[model samples]
Target: MSLTSRAATSLARQTGRQLAARPAASFQQHRNAANVAGNPNESHAHVTSPFTRGASGRQDTTVIPSFKRYRAGNEQGNKVFQYFMVGAFGGLTALGAKDTVQNFLVNMSASADVLAQAKVEVDLATIPEGKNVIIKWRGKPVFIRHRTADEIKDAENTDWQKLRDPQPDSDRVQKPEWLIMLGVCTHLGCVPIGEAGDFGGWFCPCHGSHYDISGRARKGPAPLNLEIPAYDFAEDNQVVIGT
Candidate 1:
């Protein structure tokens, strides 16, 4: 037969079989309803329905839930188990987040060996009196000036009370001859020229900021004195900068 004719015949046979099964199901439903009416106290397990018939024409057993089923003794225990499971999951998640944050902070921090090199050691023997030496420490220029006797005398004699950023020379320096300070001008972070200002100290040509021999901001727009870094005389001629 042709493909179209075969499909039509197959569809007709399936439709006929369905129509024949419907009447049998209706009859069974009517008979079951009559049996239930006749015996009102009949057991639910032996009840028959239009649907759910096995090969031997018996209905599958169905359990009807009562209100007491929900109130079973294990309900309280199940709730507690659920709460414990949620708490355990949350704790594990928090632990993972803490570990991630700790690892991130550790990666951002400097290593132990690098921290050990934080301080810079300078030999004072290489520097001469009446001259200034600029060295890099912690990525900033440090002014290490070995003052002459006349310069020290001049710094002490200068009226610190009249200066814009008032600071005594004795308080600024650790020792009389050695004057250590940062070379950066407080006005706009410009490096000042050493031994060249009006006061024979340091001059910032960028904004005409002047510093005295004692590293005091003596003139111009510079707001504060040259910053003094942390340093100590390790030996007779050796100094260590930074904590």
Candidate 2:
């Protein structure tokens, strides 16, 4: 054969061989690309995921969109709960304040009513001479003694300066025969028995205090005379005990 023909035939064989191998090479390349896509460690060229670098220099993937939506819903629900709690607290506080104001008003009204009706009246015509009568006036006991002539003379003749708590018998009575004073003893809050003392007037057995017919503290621990109620005679026998 000629040399040029031989060379051309050889080249054609080589081209045919290369063409026969082309499909296998193409399939091998496609398979390599699929393996690279399936591998977890390899980075994709076309697709990218959002990531952030942390302080440790590691990449952190973004949270899923569904998780972000759920978090936002939770935050909104929390805000609603907080608002409800605040509203309920405000309502309770207002109710408590209203109750306090009402209670204060009620107490003030009751106190005014009590003070307005504190005065009392007493009838003195039933009391006999030289005898003692006890009456209630303004929630305290008042002693009313209708003195006999002899008792008045005895009380007046006594020395006023020699008594422990000194007062003239004439100063204690608006009418000389009527002796009116509180029944409470000056030494303590005990009530005294009328006309039963060493002074022939009132005796407190609880502390052994003695008062005279004129209600002056004569002996024992009593520091002052018996308190006299503010009284005025409405008539010859009727008296008003308190203003």
Candidate 3:
């Protein structure tokens, strides 16, 4: 058979089947009506129709809601959890930004400190004779000396017992009493303590390093003498370090 002919025949068979079923359905409806009429005062129960109904037998529909129409309890909770998760992630990002800024500031401060240390400066008038004062030069501590007659004599004495390096030839201080040197200890950068008259010289308690009035390291574990900073005499009493 041709394809169009076969489709036509199948449709005809379906139509005939539906027509035959229609009569049986009508007969059953009629029988039910008759039975209902036989019983008088049967309290006519309401019946619902899909299409528009006449005033004789009309009833309201009872709607049943489908589960797919709304969210379940767990699904609602999941939405709330998603919102909280997003907020938590945002808070973490803010904290990370704060920490990054703080780290950058700390690095900048450290760089400034290094620069200050590379360039030291001082004034001569501030330091008195026979006494020493701590001055920041080139970002490091320096001892400026104002030698008295007695302290100058002590530097000249050069007694072997008092000094570890008596030669005074290979020392940081070029002069005996009127001296200037880096106050920082060469061993570990600790500033040495200088006694005006009682201790007689600079003493480092860190490693027992002793320095003369001229800031020359003489005794203890310190390997080298006190450093003489680069400086020049400004006037009669003025001095400038790291100029």
What shift in Å separates residue 127 of candidate 2 from its native position after superposition? 0.6
TM-score of every candidate relative to the true structure: 0.65, 0.54, 0.44
Model 1 lDDT tens row, 1-243 = 999999999999999999999999999999999998887647455765545545555545573434685685888898999999999999999999999999999999988867876798999999988889999887789999999999999999998898888899998888899999988899999999998888899999999988888989888999999999999999989999888
Off by over 4 Å in 2: 1-117
CA lDDT of every candidate = 0.89, 0.84, 0.68
**What residue pairs clash in candidate 2, if any at all?**
none
Q: List the residue pairs that clash in candidate 1.
A: none
Native-structure RMSD, model 2: 18.5
Report the candidate with higher lDDT, 1 versus 3. Answer: 1
Clashes of 2: 0
* lDDT score for candidate 1 against the true structure: 0.89
Best of the candidates, TM-score: 1
- lDDT (tens digit, per residue) of candidate 2 on 1-243: 999999999999999999999999999999988898797445554544445354343457654433464465477889999999999999999999999999998877747545654655667778888899887766679999999998899889999998877889888999989998989998878999998889999999999999988999988888999988788898888887776
**Judged by lDDT against the true structure, how good is candidate 3?**
0.68
Error of 3 at 172 (Å): 5.7
